[model samples]
Target: MYTHTKKPTGLCIELLESQGGLISLEDFHELWSMLRKTHSLDHLYPLPTDTEEFHLLYIIISRDQEHGDLGIHANGYGIEDEGKYRLAGFACLVVPPNERREKSILSGNPNGICDTADIRIALLPAVQKRGFGRFVVHELLGHAFDTLRIRRVTASVVSPVRPSHSAAQKKQIGFNTKQICRIFETFGFKFEGISRGAVMNTEAPEDDKPVWHDVHRMSMLVTDYFEEHIISSLSTIRSPCHKLPLKTVRLSPWDTMIQRQEEEKRDLKLWAEAPKDTLANDACDEDGENSDVETMLGDDDVDEHDWDMANDFDD
Candidate 1:
């Protein structure tokens, strides 16, 4: 639903003209093609559309102009000539407004991307370690704060130590441990806990062979708080052997007792119904015998008189 109505190109918001830079849909297509050619993922799904990803490229270019993302991504980043751009880097920028997770608690930041201007850049694989990834992110965050008139930004990426991944193993593509850490440090993104229910893999798949694992989710934010404490806070574990937190819910004894009592009562009632039902059926048989005795009185005809005479004679 996003249109290519406005876009910015080049570096420095101050250097931008009164109307700012504009990119045509054609330009976006060119960028998209370049990204595909660079990454060799022209066949991947859940990635941006050929025509669609350019819209995101538009946002990245616009924000990058003002150094918005740059303030956040600092490490392993080098500026292109005149701060224009670092070559040999690519990512499909996306808004994915509806696809974000539980960011409702983050009221100060909107849309879960951190700031209204906050832009998320998915780094292109071909240009990852060379530092263009950090540079692009830094520019995006800086522009979001300055030109876009926003406070901060947020971003996330998959963890390297994921449980399983058929695609990653199949594609021979997994996260870069050092690079991922570098990107977060550069962008002021913080480490939140791993989502417990997050699926790292699927045993069965629709189109392909059974997947053995899935990707892990990690979150980030662009803030002074994260910037000041990111390094120190990151060192909280100090070693890579940090233990995972887990909780177990125990069943209440009252519930167990109530369930046991109900079952016992039900069984007892079923057993108790047998004798009462048989005794009632026997009484019905005795009533039939009494009816037969009345039939024998047909010859006597005077039932009450006969009963009185018979009783007096018997005495």
Candidate 2:
């Protein structure tokens, strides 16, 4: 389970397993419709029409409010007394279509040790910017690395369309690629590169032609989790701030490595400079103390005379 303190109120928020199939077909339909109607899923592939065929790997986000409270409802699915937790949204992790177990086995990874998976999140509009997304992602990564033992976890964002493109084309893109990239990067995912014309935007078409958009791919390896201490660092963050770090794009693994090396060099330089600064301060303090003693002993006048004579000789 993932737990975090909600911002602004400091209330606790938890992501719990939906027990007893709490989310019924009608609930899923309503939630899916809302997301699609709001263009929230425009960056994502169409979910399966056959609800049973679609994976129900959901983690229900809940607030600290009492159960059955008259708050928002996921079509009546969220009000059930499941530990007195109010539902906010759901998040899930699914195996990518190309990285299924059969494909992994065929690729000589019988244990699927080298396989990768994808993460998906959906939240109510009210809770969108409230750090629930980050909390869910943190928990998902922990599960992927520690529980599922997956080698890599990937996330894709719909790249922004060019302004020169028709208005209809721009409307097809929903997510801000830079914002999404920053989120994943905070979790130690490196950019894998762009997938050209990866998904067709069926919602909008011009001249009866399919509108295809590029997708930005990013992934975090199991090694990155431990090497970067992502899990440990994130665990200490009780309420993740909405202000994300500065944006940067690492287009490939090589770029990521180079950035790491540059950061290490900068750190080493700072460390090396620190001691010199301390020693210089010490020398200045000693000189000041000696000068004060000389001034008290009437040697200051002689020193000033010598200083003036030295200046005259230089002239």
Best by TM-score: 2
In terms of lDDT, model 2 sits at 0.61
lDDT of each: 0.39, 0.61
Report the lDDT tens digits of candidate 1 across residue range 113-204.
Answer: 42432233443443334444445555555445544444444444433233354676534443343245344644445444334423333224
lDDT of model 1, residue 159: 36
lDDT tens readout by residue for model 2, 224-261: 87866745456455655754454344354555678899
Candidate 2 runs further than 4 Å off:
1-20, 45-56, 59-88, 97-100, 103-114, 160-175, 230-315
For candidate 1, what is the lDDT?
Answer: 0.39
Clash count, one per candidate: 23, 0
| TM-score, prediction 2 | 0.56
- Alpha-carbon runs more than 4 Å astray in model 1: 1-23, 37-118, 122-130, 149-152, 158-172, 175-178, 193-222, 225-315
